[model samples]
Target chain A: MTHKIDIKNLNLYYDEFHALKSVNMVVGEKNIIALIGPSGCGKSTLLRTINRMNDLIEGVRITGEVFLDGNNIYDPGMDLYELRKRVGMVFQRPNPFAKSVSENVAFGLRVAQFKNKKKIAEIVERSLRAAGLWDELKDKLNRPALDLPLYQQQRLCIARLLAVEPEVILMDEPCSALDPIATMKIEEMMVELKRNYNIIIVTHNMQQAARVSDLCGYMLLGEMIEFNKTSEIFTNPRDKRTQDYITGRFG
Target chain B: MMKLFSEKSIKKALTVIAFSAIAALLLIVVFIILEGLPFIFKVGISDFLFSSEWEPQMGRFGIFPMIIGSLVVTLGSMIVGIPLALSGAIFLSEFVPRWAMRIIKPTIELLAGIPSVVYGFIGVMVLAPLIRDYLGGPGLSILAASIILGIMILPTILSISIDSLKAVPQSYREGAFALGATHWQTIHMAVLPAAKSGIIAGIILGLGRAIGETMAVIMVTGNAVILPKSPLYSVRTLTANIALEMGYATGMHRQSLFATGVILLIIIMVLNYTATIAIRRRVGKK
Candidate 1:
């Protein structure tokens, strides 16, 4: 299968600290790929490279290539904002804008230049439905998004990403801020969402990577130690480190 | 040393400090009201508040002109000051590099440390002349005072606004960028809305600063007693009015100056109440 995103020898530095060290990875089409690593292992850093979100950080110097749909996103004079539009991201913490429910969902569309009010309203409703938040929020469409409970807020964030029609979604430990039940719901939503868009998730929870992902890449320090099918990585033979990590030996 | 003389003693000491601060504030307010209210009652509230005539020797004290002057000048200063302060705040909080911010923020705040008399001296030497030269009417007009006060209040508004903007989480910016928003769009749509109440507080605080200013205002605003028709016209504000007459006046004139204090106190109380509500709403949201 043609990969949705391909990264080759990706190296990133934040000032003097070497963040991601010559990372190489591939995410298959419409599939869920999880990056499992310890805290500060550069998994989230690798994920941010896909959408050039790292550019927002000061003193970040990146080398190597991240390709989205066979197009090198790190090419010189690239439209960074346009690249971001096609590859959406959800943060570890749910960060809905301090706006009404409908307004939060409609924010991406508005940024993308959708000015017709009726059209925006319809798309807002549809995206919320896809993220499984429509029915819960339909009645309180005008209530501030911050008023929602934590899980609902994350779901609303997902709905916001979906509104821009992104071909791929990057989630950085999306459920880390959520409870176990909320985590389960987000995992289920991810499984369902994979039918429409490619997903790359960086997670600290190995069990979550096992339970929700189709494939897994075990990362250590700043390197990807193993990349394979979830079952093979979790149940069978693999890199000694991946096996050790999954078996609860050491991160 | 026995747990710092026990937590109970510390608590009692703290309570005493807090109560003393409250007691001091109460004393000042009661003193002013007691000194001023008898004059207001003797003159009648309507004549005191609504009439514009003022001759302490003639027993005619209508400060309607000064009240209007204070409002007009304060509003003008905010109009001149807020947009610059707000834009500068946004640049500081969202765009400036860390190294630059370290230098720039302290420099902006230092503007507040300049003595009001120094600002007044500059207004006399530089600003008033420019206004008189260009805008007419002796240069020390409401326009001059507004510009001076506008500059005076910039640090207050800019610093407070920057604080509010900084309080907004980085996650909001990341979320906006992930949706492909340009920096300006993200700041306008996401960051600004989140910092709204704090910005309002900053503006209100700037307004309070402008309204209460005396020395700088007295120097720049020609201190005319007539009702001001335009920004170019010379006008005397409530604070300037009291400062101008309190030295020579006797009896009722002295108390009337205290009455002016009563009016200034009321205006400040209203502004302080509004600012507290805004600050509370901002904190409550988090």
Candidate 2:
């Protein structure tokens, strides 16, 4: 299977605090992968590495290569905006822009200077439809995005990412703020999304990983302890720590 | 029983203290209206407002020129100040490093603490001469006053705007960046729009400060009681008129000054009301 993303010996430090140790992993195209671990286990940190969001932080030092479609993203000449355009992210909380629903979905295209209003509207409608928000939000496109319910807002954020036509969607605990029903809705969308895009999610819920992801990687103390098929990781983790964490032992 | 008694008494005392401020404000408003309205009625409303004649000794009481002067100067100051103050705010809030901003922000705020008289002095000695040499007309003209008032209101506008910009959620910025927005695009699209109402509030406050400014305006506006033809023309604002004439005036002249105060009060209240409505509209949309 062709790899969508290749991380080679990735190490990240935030001002002498080692966040991600020497780590390597490859993500296949068109699958849902879940990274599960306790808090501060570098799961979210590793997820941010793909689009270089860590560069926004002060005093962050990274030494490794993250390649998307066989091109090293860490190269000095790489266009950061281009990299992020291809690799979109959804945050832990629903963070739609302080704008109308249509404008929120059209944010990416507007930034890219897409001047054709009709085409932009079409993409906005299509993206909202893909995220299953079109039927509910179509009439309320002019309403402020913050006024929406949490689940709808999260789906709106997903639609925002879809507007940019990203190949890889990085979700850092996208359903952490959501109730079980909302969480299930987001998980169902994730499952549906994997057919067209490589979806990498960092989540704390082990059961969510089991239910939605084809592949799962258990992380411990900035290291990838074990990664395999989700069923294998759940039923028979190769590492003792992974098994301990899976079976309700110490995190 | 002793603790409960003391608590009730303390609450009563605090309420009185808060009410005292309101009482003082109400008293002042009533006093200004009582003193000013009779004189306005005596002068006839249209002649008082529309006629440009302002000579007190001749009993000519028209304040049309001063009204125009105040609006023109305030408008000029806004033109000069808003862009500079807003850009400074955006730079401090978004682009500058924290350590650098810490130093720079306080230094700009220090501009506010410097006495307005000092700003006027600088205007007289430096800015006026430069304008006269290069831009023509009297050195102390509407243009000169506007520039000084612009600099004076900079800190007020800048600090409030920075606070508003900083108040924008970090998540909005992250959301924009996660979609491939450049730094400028994120700020322009997400942060600025979210902060619009607060920034507008800052500008309104600065407008109030500019309109009510007495000392620097009196010093540099040349105190000419006429409708200004250009920014280079010397003009007298309403505040300047009151300050320039309040001393040794009696009878109707004294009431006219009070009327000026009433007008100034009305302008400020209108500005504040507009700002509240603007901010409320934004909140209502949300």
Candidate 3:
């Protein structure tokens, strides 16, 4: 499989505390990869580093390389704007902008300076359909995004990411705030999305990782303990620490 | 068996206290209206609203110029004060570190506590002459009044705008940044829109302060009885007119000043009502 993202010896720190320590992993193209860890284990921090979201925080220091499409993202001359345009992110909780549903999906395209109104409208509809929310929300494009139900809002956020046409989608516990049914819908959506875009999701739910991801990485104390196919990692793991964590021996 | 009081009694007492406070405010309005009603009825409504001549000794009581002066001064203050206050608020809320916030927040609060009279004295002794020299006026005009009023209302606008901007959830900003928005872009698109109603409320409150302000404006505004012809022209605002001439005037003259008070009250009431409606609509949309 061709690698879409390659992280080599990446380390991240917030002030004095080391958050991600020398993490190395490669995510294949158009595949779903899940990072499973307990709270404070740096799963979210690792996910954020892929898109440079941690740049907003003060006293954050990063070391090593994150290559997107064979180019080092940490290169001093790399434009963050263009990099982020190619790599989109969805948050844990639904965070639709204080705008209409159509406007929410159109936000990134508008920011990227796409002036063709017809093209924007077509993309909005296509993105909504891709996220499997078009049938329910087709008639209410003018409604505020926040007025939607939690599950629908999450899907709308997904549609918004899709509108940007990013190669990779990073999700930080995207279904953590959702109910079981909503989580199931999102899991189904992820399987469908894998045909077109590479996805890296950090989740606390071991079963979710088992169900939705083709590859699973088990992390603890800011270190990657094991990375393998999800079936092998769950059924025939090599590392004892990975086994203990997968079986819920200790978080 | 141990309970001596019912829930109904506590509810009743709370309702009565709340209504009483509201009723007390209404009574003050009614008293002002009743005391000023005789002159309003005698002079008719159109003259009181549109006439510019306000000679109390000769029984001429036109309040149009003072009304125009109040409008111009209040608008000037808002134009100057809102942007300064908003920028100060954004810096305080978004850029200032936690340790620095402890020092800066209180300094702003200290501005709010400074007496209006001290602000008046500053305008009279310092700012008026500066404007006179630089802007080429009589050291006291609508421009001077606006400058003084703007300074007086700065702390109010800044503190409230900061609170409103802080009240916006961090999730919105994170969402914008995660979508690749720069700091200023995130603030402009997400943070400012979310905090729009609160910032407008702060501006409206500052406007109320400007419209009703007396001592500071009276000290610097030349207090001429004519409407301001320009930024450098002298004028007397509604509040200043009342404050300046209310003493020693007898009968209908005193009543006419009270009528001016009624007119000022009505203007502020309209402004407050519009602001309240706008804020409610924004909150509802959110």
> Best TM-score goes to which candidate?
2
Interface RMSD of each: 0.6, 1.5, 1.8
| Per-residue lDDT of model 3, residues B1-286, tens digit only | 3244667777889999999999999999998899887789899898888987788888888899988988998998887788789899999999988799889888987987788888889988998899889989797877777777887789888988888898888888887776667778888888887888888988888888889988888888888888677888888899998888888778989899889889999999998987797678667855
Model 2 agreement with the true structure over B1-286: per-residue lDDT tens digits: 9999999999999999999999999999999999988888899989888899998888999999999989988998999999999999999999998899889989998999999999899988998899999999888999999999999999999998998898888899989999999999999999999999889988999999999998999888888998888898889999999988999888888999998888888999999998888778766755
Candidate 2 residue pairs in clash (backbone atoms < 3 Å): none
lDDT of each: 0.92, 0.92, 0.88
TM-score of each: 0.96, 0.98, 0.95
Instruction: Say which candidate scores most in lDDT.
Output: 2
Docking class of 1: high
Candidate ranking (TM-score, best to worst): 2, 1, 3
The i-RMS of candidate 2 is 1.5
Evaluate residue B5 in candidate 2 and report its C-alpha lDDT on the 0 to 100 scale: 100
Candidate 2's displacement at residue A80, Å, is 0.6
DockQ of each: 0.88, 0.73, 0.58
Superposed by TM-score, candidate 2 places the C-alpha of residue A8 at a distance from the truth, in angstroms, of 0.9
> What does candidate 3's lDDT look like per residue over A12-79, in tens digits?
99999999999999987888999998899999999989999888789999999999988899999888
* Model 2, C-alpha of B68: deviation from truth (Å): 1.1
Stronger candidate by lDDT (1 vs 3): 1
Docking class of 2: medium
First chain TM-score, candidate 3 = 0.98
